[model samples]
Target: MHTPKADYPLSEIRRFLEPGPIVLVGSAWKGRRNVMAMGWHMMLGFSPALFACYIWEGNHSYEMLRRSRECTINLPTVSMMDQVAGIGNCSGRSLDKFETFGLSTSAGGHVDAPLIDDCPANFECRLVDERQIPEYGLFIWEVVKAHVRPDPELPTTMHYLGRGEFMTSGAIVSRRDEFRPGNL
Candidate 1:
C-alpha cells in the first residue's frame, strides 16, 4: 500500500532554526550518560570560563545533567549526521544509546562524565549555576578542560534544530584575515 507523506516548506523550517552549527552537549551519571542535541547554548564568559545550555527539565539528559552537575560538550563534524540524529531520537532510559548506536566514549578525569569519541572537540565541564525558567529549564556550566582531536583537518561543527532537522556548517569562504594590524 502507498500513502502520501505530508510535506512542509523548507523555508518555514529554516525560520525556526535561528542559530547555526551548534556543538552537541552530553552528560553522564555513573557511566550512564545522555546526549542532548541542542541549539540553545553559548559561551557566557572567558576568564572564569562559563557556558550556558538550555534544556527542558523533563528531558532525560537534563535530569541526569542536573543531578550530576557536569557534562562533556562534544563537537561533532558533518560526517556524524546520522549518529547525531539517532541519539536525539531515542532516550537513554529505554535504550543503551551508546552501545546500540555504536557510539564510543572515554572517561573524563576532572568530571565524572564520558567524553564522546569520534567528535572533533570536547570540553569537560562542571555546573557553576543554574537558572530555572518554567518556559525552558536552562542550565549554565563552566568548562574545565578541553580536548581536541589529533587530526587538524577536521570539518566545522554540526547542529540540530527541532524535529529530525540538522545542518552542517559551511566553510568560511570569505572573511578578513586579521582584525588588528600586527595580529598576523
Candidate 2:
C-alpha cells in the first residue's frame, strides 16, 4: 500500500510543485515595449481578479513594470514551445522579441502593454500593490480586462519542470458529484 521514499534536495522542489503554465508577460514604458517569459505567477483571488508574480530586479521588464504600473499576461499553448524557450533565454534589452520569435501583438483595452495576438488568452493587469517589490521582488496585480479565444476552449498548457524541462497538461478529471455544494 505504501512506497519507500528517499531524500530529495529542496532546490528541486519546484520541479514537483511548480504551479500554472509559463506565461509571456508584456510590458511597455516610455514608448518602449517588451515581452518576457514568466513562470512564477499564481492567482490570488476571484472577485477582483487578483494575481501575484515574482520578477527579479535584474530583469529588464522589472523596472518597466514598476514604472508603467501595468502589463499584459499572455498564455501560450503547447505548440508555442519554441517561442517560449527562446523568449525566456534571451534578454529584451538587445532585440525585439516579438519580431525575433515571429510573434505578433495587439493593444489591450485597459493597459499600455501589448497583448500577444497568438495567445489563446490574455489579461490586462494594473499593479495594485508595490509593498512586496523591494523586499521580495513580488508584484500584486488586479486583472482589469481579460480576453479569450472562443475556439478550442481547453487548450493544453505547458508547465515548467526546471532544469530545462517541461510537463504538458493532460486529460481532465471531474468529481463534481463528490464535492460539497458550498465548496463548488
Candidate 3:
C-alpha cells in the first residue's frame, strides 16, 4: 500500500524539495577574496551556460560580487563537509576565509576571482542580469569557463536539509532508456 502523506510546514519544504548541492561561492574584488557556502543555486539554462544564485544584501560577498560582476563557483565534495560547514557558519567580514580554512586557490582564467584548488569542479561566471536584485536577491550569471577533475566521474555532494542537517548524494539511478532522445 502507498504510504500516507502528512502536511508539512511551508518553511521546512526545502528538506523535501532541495534545489541542488551545497557549493562554495568564490568572490573577489580589488585584491580581496572571500568564500561563502551557498545551496540555493541551480542550473537555469544550457546554451549560454546560464546559472542563477541568490545572495542576501547583508552577506559580506554581496557588495564585492555586485561590483566585481564575476565569481567562481566551486563544487565541494562530501569529504569537505566540515570545511563547508565552517565556511557557512562564519562571516567573511573580518577574516580571510582561505587562510582560516587553509583552502588553496588558483586565479580564474576569465574572472578575477580565485577558484578553490581542492574542489573537483570550478566554473568561472560573469554577471549577466541584475534586474531581480531589487525585488529578489537573485543574480543571473553566464559561465564563461569551466574546469573539472576527471578522476571521479561522479562525486558525492552535500545537500542542505535545513536545521543544521544535510544529506549526501546517493547512488545514481539512470532512466535514459525511458526518455525520448529530445528529452534526454
Candidate 4:
C-alpha cells in the first residue's frame, strides 16, 4: 500500500534535495586566513576536477576567496561535528576560526590557501571563473592539488539537514566489478 504524502513548503525542499557532504572551506588573503563551514557545493566534473560552491556576498570568506582566488576544501569526520557547528555559528571576520576551534593548518602545495590538518582529505583549488558571482554568487574552481590520509578506508562524514540537524554518512555497498575499465 502507498503511504499518504503531505505537501511541504518550497523553503523545506532543500532538506530533501541537498545531498552533498559538508566541508570546511579554508581561504587566505593578504596574510589573513579563515575557515568557514560550508554545505552548498557540488562536484561538476571528473577530468581536471571541477567544483562549484555558492558563497553569499555577506560571508567574510566570500571576500577573502574573491581576493585570493583560491581555497582548500577540507572534509571533516563525524567526530568533529561540534567544531563544524561552532564554526558555522561564528563569523570569520570577527574571530579567527582556526584559533577558536583549535584547528591546525598547513600551507597548500599549489595555492596560498591553508589546509586543515585534522581533515582526512583536503582539496586545493583555484578559481577558474567568477562570471556568475553577481547573479548567483557561484564560484567555479579547478582542483590543483589533493591530499588524503594514508588509510584505505574513509571516515564518516556528515550532511546538513537544515535547522541545526545533520545526518552522518552510513553504510557503503560496493559494485566495483560491475563497471567496465573505461566506463568509470
Best by lDDT: 2
TM-score of each: 0.77, 0.88, 0.89, 0.85
Query: lDDT score, residue 166, model 3?
Result: 94
Candidate 3 segments whose C-alpha is farther than 4 A from its true place:
1-19
Question: Under the 3 Å rule for N, CA and C atoms, how many clashes does model 3 have?
Answer: 0
Relative to the unseen true structure, what is the C-alpha lDDT of residue 177 in candidate 4, on a scale of 0 to 100? 96
Cα lDDT tens digits for candidate 2, 49-127:
7789999899899999999999998888889998999999998998989889999788877899998877877788899
- Among all windows of ten consecutive residues in candidate 3, which has the lowest summed lDDT? 1-10
The digit string of per-residue lDDT tens for model 3 on 30-72 reads 8889999998887776657778989989999999999999998
lDDT of 4 by residue, 1-59 (tens): 21222222322222222347899999999999998889999777666677899998899
Error of 4 at 183 (Å): 5.1
| Residue 55 lDDT, candidate 1, scale 0-100 | 82
- Candidate 1: Cα lDDT at 54: 83
Which lDDT tens digits does candidate 1 get at residues 59-152? 7887788889899877767777787777766778787778877878877778877778777566778988875534567787777777665445
Instruction: Pull out the clashing pairs in model 1.
Output: none
Tell me the spans in candidate 4 whose CA falls farther than 4 Å from its real position.
1-19, 175-183
Off-target runs (Cα >4 Å) in candidate 2 are: 1-19
Clashes of each: 0, 0, 0, 0
Cα lDDT, all candidates: 0.67, 0.82, 0.81, 0.80
